[model samples]
Target chain A: MHTTLAWIDYLIMVIYFAFVLGIGFALKRFMKTSTDFFLSGRSIPAWVAGLAFISANLGAQEVIGMAASGAKYGISTAHFYWLGAIPAMVFVGLFMMPFYYGSRARSVPEYLRLRFDEKTRGLNAISFAAMTIFSSGASMYAMAKLIGVLHIFDPVVHALGLPTGYVFHLSILVSAVITLGYVYLGGLTSAIYNEVLQFFLIVAGFFPLVWLGLKNVGGWEGLIAKCPPGFGHAWKGMTNADTNPLGVEWFALAMGLGFVLSFGYWCTDFLVVQRAMAADSMTSARRTPLIAALPKMAFPFLVILPGLIAVALPTPTAVEAPTSASASVVEADALGHGLIPAKVKTDGSIERDSAGQPVLDYDLAIPKLLLHYFPAGLLGLGLTALLASFMSGMAGNITAFNTVWTFDIYQAYIKPEASDKHYLRMGHFATLFGTAISIAAAYVVASYNNIMELLQLVFAFVNAPLLGTFLLGMFWKRATANGAFFGLLSGIGAAAVHHGVSLPAGSVPGVKGAWINRGAEFVANLAGWSPRLPFHAYRNEMAQNFWTAIWAFGVCFVVTIVVSLATKPRPDEELKGLVYSLTKHDVEHGLPWYRKPEVLGVAVVLMSIALNVIFR
Target chain B: MNLDIRVPIGLLFLSLGGLLTGYGVVTHFTSPEIYAQSLDVNVNFWWGLAMLAFGAGMLHYGRRAVARSTAAVGAE
Candidate 1:
């Protein structure tokens, strides 16, 4: 399990750590008020906010998960970037930023309060705060497990005379301390600044790996030749869910991912929106997501290309993996696609499917490729880049949690009016506790992985409903508070019921779904149902996923409209800046043609469409 | 607030690039076989050079920005 690391690699990691901490110390003097600590005094540049916006999402799971998707689904995985995030990012910048920035609300949940009611804000604040800490913990657990698996710290373990098992504990402790140190010292400003630096470092590290890999795989032509049909294409075979690589047809893909999931996340998730909220002016805030969209669209080449390359290359029976995290012994050729290792169980044996074929640990695609190609010095840089992403993501989650807890939960509910200095102190205190709980949650994840998965699934179900609530609250002044509150609850309930009857093709009728099999169908039959049941087993989990989103959003959209017409509407005068139609839409008037978000929005969409065509 | 972000990023990468290039030079003379694993391309040297160029650009741009802001403040 030992991965080779030269002195140069250790030095590289140390220097990176020093730079992060130094940035924190340098920004410490500016934290005299809670506004500075939590919001960066709204003085950040658009580009910096933009980079942080993307970097906040560049967690270990995201990088690994995207690559895994690339390995499993081929170039179609880019659809997640091109179709899923880019449009939502543009919409948030051009359309949503006016309400978010103009309203003097400090947090997303705070905005909910101004637009809707305190009850709605409280519901969102509590759930968001809880999700961030646990998600951060889950990511922390993943990072520590990765460090332990890679055995990069074997020499340090030997030098310190610690047991091999303690490496995991040490990794967790070190990450927590480093993350807490910078965040506590300088708060949101430090996190945002470090994220921008990490953005460059990530590019520096991965760009080379991809270059070497493309060369190894004999360039684009060779990759196309080596891959299976449609592996290199984004739009091929997308008409039918059964044939589509993503197992969801075009309309569901467009509506479910492109609209519901994308807007739900990019527009409402405070983790990224907070970065934009830190911008110096309304114009910068409007530009933040747009600027982020440019790099974001190009990231598939950086992150997803490695997986495509890994599959195209052949596996050496026994790869002398330089940074071997998995067993060096390769399985039968019938088992694996390429250099990607077979999924191993807790007992350290390869996991095989019901078909007797080995299921690849697609998550290890990036790790194996890094080990297969990188030498010592450059290897260090790559691993450091990976570690930087994990830390950055952790810090992103904590920063968001603290703000929500401080402003939405604490300031709103606990102590209605605290002094500026007292609130600043509370911000630091929140960071400390948020991180501590994350550490504890990391241990909980290590023990009860299933519960964590279920929790994440529940969290996913809760997310798509948010965009429905936000869309109504922001665009429609006639949308009532009661409508929003009840509509959100109905959307979540619909997602649950949708999951109740549906199941992915192969999976059993359990937590994966179809738990309500016999009774609902029997009842429907007794009632002499006119048409076929739409909520039956889907082609795959992805098919079920897209439908679930559509169901939730569809339900919330109708319910909110129905309820709004029945209930009393808030006065239009009180909703000036918070409602889109009421806000000043021509604020971009003086900006040059190139600077306007609408122009950039069009250009970004066109570029992404070109990418879809090129890959297709 | 005064600390421009590009300065730290520039300085960090500058040192990192310098380290890699220096090490690459020493290894090219001392242990030539180390480059074999990385497809014999001296990634440390070439990529280090690329990073060095980028780092210096960031540093120069950041310094000019800081200077301009300071000059504006002084004028006021």
Candidate 2:
């Protein structure tokens, strides 16, 4: 069914868009230098930066993807925030923030150059730049696709005689222009300030959705009563892989997601780190992630509750799948699942699960519930929240891309001797360039979706290895440039090789791995004589992803240590601010106990653990 | 640093809340049927009012901050 919007909805959207542009327009005059444009002149408050840090990552993927996972896996998805992000954010705040803030590196890759060698920095900067653009574009594609599917603007567009197909193109164009307009005019300050606004707007929008939804579904306990056993529990069935919907046991979950992947994304990725780096002072910088953790740990409730409510509501009359599910509407209704429509293919045929029942389009969980529960006025706010998420996500990438390009790539290599003014001009040029390419990439994603998957897998291989390099480089002063460079390469190689050999169960070769030997049987044959060498396929793609990261981290960690021992160390004086042992931790003696990173870190961790226990 | 970001955020929310609350009030008086999808509750009225209060709070804090900064500058 086409979900049409009333004039009130249109008015809400117009107000939101106006505020976004006006903020950018307001900030344009203060963007006097590259530092202001790129780093917010190191003047943003801790709370603001903290909010931006989380908001920058809150793309369509995080909101929609988490909701989707919540529908399919139940409360198990909370592990992503509670077990995954909380510890990592706290770690970054209490441990890694000192080096990042103290080093005065303009970007994450620049920090690599200061700690590691040039080649390592180059490899990181290029891959990271490409990854950010692609992901930004992919999110753009998803948002546009969702807008088309919702058909919320169909009334106005159709009245204008606009064809249905152009909805995707119109959505993409509108988002791209607004994103470019803000980032181009005011730079990172604009992006960060707007990210803060987006954060609040998203809460303003989705919070009520969750509230209204829970009331309808009889609150948390009532919803849990309708679900299967362990559906509301976070740690249940986590002892083994097959018992849990996540398809990975507790050990793998802790080591892979909690330790390696979380640290990799939060600590190393420039998108979130940039926010911390923009803070006004070292203390604020360190506190960025710590403050962010407060909202982050509770985010699952806002993003995931709609799905739980959707699944728990007594099954409504089944809305038949787009075209071919007409024959099985009764069958779908009999399954006692409702609201979530079936996933359909390009040919409009219903996609089926292994049991031959229609597979729900879980990504539509949030959208469907919003339409079901919200009236015209609130519907506008909810849709605006979604649109804000997509734009902020894209803007985050654009800002990061321009900074890395201008600082790491242009000044470092292209023209080593240029006035600061020239470089500032280059940053503007880079913003235009990055946004243009991202728009092009969005079109590419619309055509061949596999490129996004392939890019994501590439990102997994790339990002997973870097945390090992950073850990060794910062903690082990002996980690030489050669060691870091080769160790990183070897880590990436090990990740690729492991993925190339072991496939996820029931999946064919290609994006899901096992492209090399097609099975673990072949790899196991090399050490087949020993029972311990019996390697089998992973339970799912996530299981494979976690293991791949583990292999990469392990190899990179060991190789970096060995190579560092063999190679000459960078002198202690050279490593002063960058290395943990060499650097002096700034004493915040004047601050009260509650203001300390240690205090905040402990508080955040305990709160997250409390959540796990409560949910468990 | 450029400008207090909270000021703009406050203004945006204030206007948004006003529009929503106005619409909600109109519908509350003229036609309550608009809230049927929302389980017979006037979400627009309630949530809009909540937003307006939040916006007002933010603006109050933001203005105080600006005033305090200016006063400190004058004292210096």
Candidate 3:
């Protein structure tokens, strides 16, 4: 599919880039100290913080992945928003924000150091820093790859007579430079402000696409009529893994994604929590994530509905293949499901099948809809919004990386007694270093199959068991520092081992497959052990991820509890403001009914329940 | 005192809204072909107006907040 952007579209995108850079330069005066640079001086208002909180998490993977899932899996993809996000967001706002904000920890890893011990803090800090860099790299890779696939810049390149070969590398370099410039100027505050702007732009960009698509498809009723059975329901075939598009049981969805992954990300991931922690007051900090939940719940309509509507539209005859070294044509099967992969020609268009039908690429659902539905000026706005989302995600990662690197790694380990100005300078250097590393990481991410699935797998390996350690440390005073650290290590090890042993048939590359096969044979021959472990066979990679997280969480929880019981624990006095039981309960009775976190949390939960019931 | 974000955000939106609205009006009578893809809805015009109104409200609130804080400081 060729991009449909005109000169007007290019103009709009230029204006957006100007506004983003303008905001960064405008906010440079505020960054007089490290606190302001990293945390916005902890004085951002709740609404601004709330929008930025959600927007920072909205990256290239989220926008493209959700739409792709909507087209592939139908309405069940809303589970990522409603079930996987809202509840955890509410829990963080109502219950977890006090420790995160009240204790005045510089970062999440700092909180771990306070609550657990040095080793626990060290593990979390190093892993979190690495994850942020990797995540940033992934976002960069996704944006460059997406721009290449959509050929959005083809017109400009052709007009300028530039070579088409360097488009992907150019996209990466341009985006990296833009992000680095702004982040270097205003730091986290710049990232946060840009994220808020991006949130508005994204809403404005996609609302029209959804409206036009729905109108063309004859509304919700038309969508239900055109799509396959069970496509309209969120929980219909969820009870049985084999019957659903997700191909995962309801238990795994609830326990693994809903409980482990959601809480791990929402509560502990510094990328998002840092936004809320920048709120002006305790009440605002507590309310920040709750306010974010409102938009989070509504995002399925903006992002996911376009994909569903794209699928409901009449099937297209021709499609473009992904621009990889091995470009493959994707063809539809007997039931109109496109999964078969064929070779493609060098010109980027799909090679026709034996029946003379051009293969369709479902991942292009949103971009194709933008091309088909939006007008000229609005198309520019939509493309700008897409670019804004990518930049916002990368900026968030870079900002988080700089903060963690400066405070957790440099301040704590490199120079513990550094002055504020010294750390602030270090933050600037870290931003540059982190951006360079992320560019390298983006190059490394060329091999990944699906952006969203890869992210989920990463979360399973890192965040799942980390959630268990945090859960025990916060509520249970008996949890020892040694227990938490070792438990986390074992949990990550469990996820890796599960992935290694359950290696899906023919999924591994040739070299890795040969080595793994040899290792399996040696183990079986030496110990008389079966090559395969006794685990339930999953239908999809997502299901495998869910099971891996579930097992990891169980192992972490059990190991932490057992080791804590066996070891000595920290005294209660030492745990004040760190442990829930030891901390004082500060109630805000003066606030109005709606301003209260519990009130809003309950409402958010009720709304989520209503959504589930409506689509069940 | 810290600068309120609303002022800058409001100004940015107001500028964008003005640009879009002006373009929409210029193109409405002269060139209808520009909006042929969106069913001739003139989306830029209506959305621009909505943004202008929102931006104005934010600017008003931000100014009032600044006034109140300045008055308190003078009283102190």
Candidate 4:
């Protein structure tokens, strides 16, 4: 079924776009220097920065992917938010923010240079720059694909006399232009401001959808009753890999995802950290991620609940089926028991079976909910919220890209003696360059079938080992620069080796597989050996990703410690403010009970534990 | 902090909230057919009211802070 939006929806979207652009233009005067452009002069309030911090990470994949996981794996997916995110966010707020905000570094890699050495910074900067571009492209691709599948702009395209096929290309161009325009005009300030706005819009948009869906499904008790066995509880079937929808054991879930991947993304990734670092004061900076954790903890109800609700709803199936007992058995087997099965055509239409029943596509759960429940005015707001999320994610990447390029790479390597004005100009130009590259990356992602899976693989390759390097660099005063640099390299090498050996059959199709296999063969030949490795298949790609990160973190941690002990350590004076032990302990005794980070941190942790217990 | 982003954001949300609230009120007496999809919840009305309250709070705090900052500048 094709869902078409009303004119009021279009008007609402236009108004949202106008406000976004107006904010960008309005903030342009504030960008008189590089600091203002890149870091908002470190003057944003905790609430605003906190909202933006979470919004930057809430891209198209996050919203759509979370709902999709909810439908497929049930509440087990809440592990991502509870075990995977909350603890890591709290750890960053309470322990790591002091160094990040105190070191006076402009970017995460800049922090590395202060703590470790130039080579470590360069390695991180180059990889981080590349990763952000790819991530931006992935967001663009997901937005375009979602728009096309949902037929969100079909009415506009038809009214404009444009072919329906141009919808994908149009979605990409419009999002790219809008993001580039705002980010170019106002820099990180604009991005943060819009991210806050997007955060509110997302909550406003999805709140009604979840409410309406729950009401239709007869509320929480109804949902539990309708869903299959083991669907309501988070930890019921988590004892063994084969018993659960996630098909992964609790040990791996806790250690691999909860500890490794979560910390890697939350602590080390500059996309989220940049928002926290832009806070007005050290106290605000420390509290930014903590404030974000409040909403982060509660987000599953908004995004994931729809998926569970969709599963409880009756599956749309073909209208007619064979009446014979043998035919009924075959149909039942083909439908995969209780799972929703849709007969999707090449043209994106859902075809009715012989029984004339409409089939359901689980990926369309959220959009279907929106289309079914919202009226003209609210529908427009919902679409605008989606568009806002996509733009915020893209802007987040572009801003980070420009800052790292201008500060870490260009200023540090290309020309060390450039004026402040010259660096500021470079930042502007880098925004354009980053947007263009992201547009290209979006096209590359379009060629892939699953954007989220591809992104997870990319995260595994880059973030896991990087987190290891940061973990040791921050807490361990004895970690030498040489150890950090080499450990990072070996850690990444371990990740690649693990992936190459354990690659599932038919995971990479056609040209990509050929290229990867050729590279592997060349490496094997160089080492005077054949390219035969043991095949360790995983239950799913997510399991593989968790193991990849686990192995990478292990390698980096062991190697960094071994190498650090072998090499001379930096002086205590030189390590001041950069190392935890060397830094002074200045307690904020004047602050009230609620304002303190420790109090807030404990409260957030307690809330997360409460959620885990309830859900589990 | 210098610009007080709350003012502009507050203005935008307030306008949108007013528009949605007005629509909701107009349709409330007539019982519009479109709201049938939302299980007759009138989500627009309730959410609009919520947004209105939030926007008014933001504007209140934002304007007061702006005035305070201006007064401090005059004293200096």
Query: What are the DockQ scores of the candidates, in order?
Result: 0.71, 0.73, 0.45, 0.57
DockQ of 4: 0.57
Error of 3 at A217 (Å): 0.3
Task: State the lDDT of candidate 4 residue by residue for A1-616, as single tens digits.
Answer: 2256666677788888898898889899889999999999998989999999999999866787788778878888888899989999999999999999999999999999999999999999999999999999989988887787666787678888999878988999999999998999998999999998888889888988888888888999998888777778888878898898887899889888899889999999999999999999999999999999999999999888888887787643444322432333234324522334453555544555456764444556677667667887788788888888889999999999999999999999998988999999999999999999999988887443334556767777788898889889988899999999999999898888777666543354222223345566679999998875345767777777788888898999999999999999899999999989899967877899889998999999999999999988
**Predicted candidate 1 versus true structure: per-residue lDDT over A1-616, tens digit per residue:** 1366899999999999999999999999999999999999999999999999999988865677677777777888888789989999999998898888888688999999999999989988998998888878887887787676566787798789998888888988998899999999999999999899989999998999889988987898887778767778888888888776778889988888788877888899999999999999989999999999999999999988888887887865555433344453344322567767665565767777677777676766777788777877788889888888888989999999999999999999999787988889899999999999999989877432222223335445777888899998989889999899888889988998888889877666667887677456667889997434444878866667778888998898899889999998888889988888777676566889999878899999999999988988
Alpha-carbon deviation at A117 in model 1, angstroms = 0.1
Pairs clashing in candidate 3? Answer: none
- Expressed as tens digits, the lDDT of each residue in A82-194 for candidate 3 is 99899999998988899989889989999999888888888988998999899999998887876776667866667777787567888899999999989999888888888
TM-score of 2: 0.93
Model 2, C-alpha of B49: deviation from truth (Å)? 0.4
Q: What is the lDDT of residue A433 in candidate 2?
A: 88
Q: What TM-score quantifies how close candidate 3 is to the native fold? A: 0.91
**What order do candidates take by lDDT, descending?**
2, 1, 4, 3
TM per candidate comes to 0.94, 0.93, 0.91, 0.91
lDDT of 3 at A335: 20
Tell me the lDDT of model 3 at A71: 80
Model 4 interface Cα RMSD in Å? 2.0
Where does model 2 exceed 4 Å of error?
A318-336, A353-355, A446-459, A518-536, B74-76
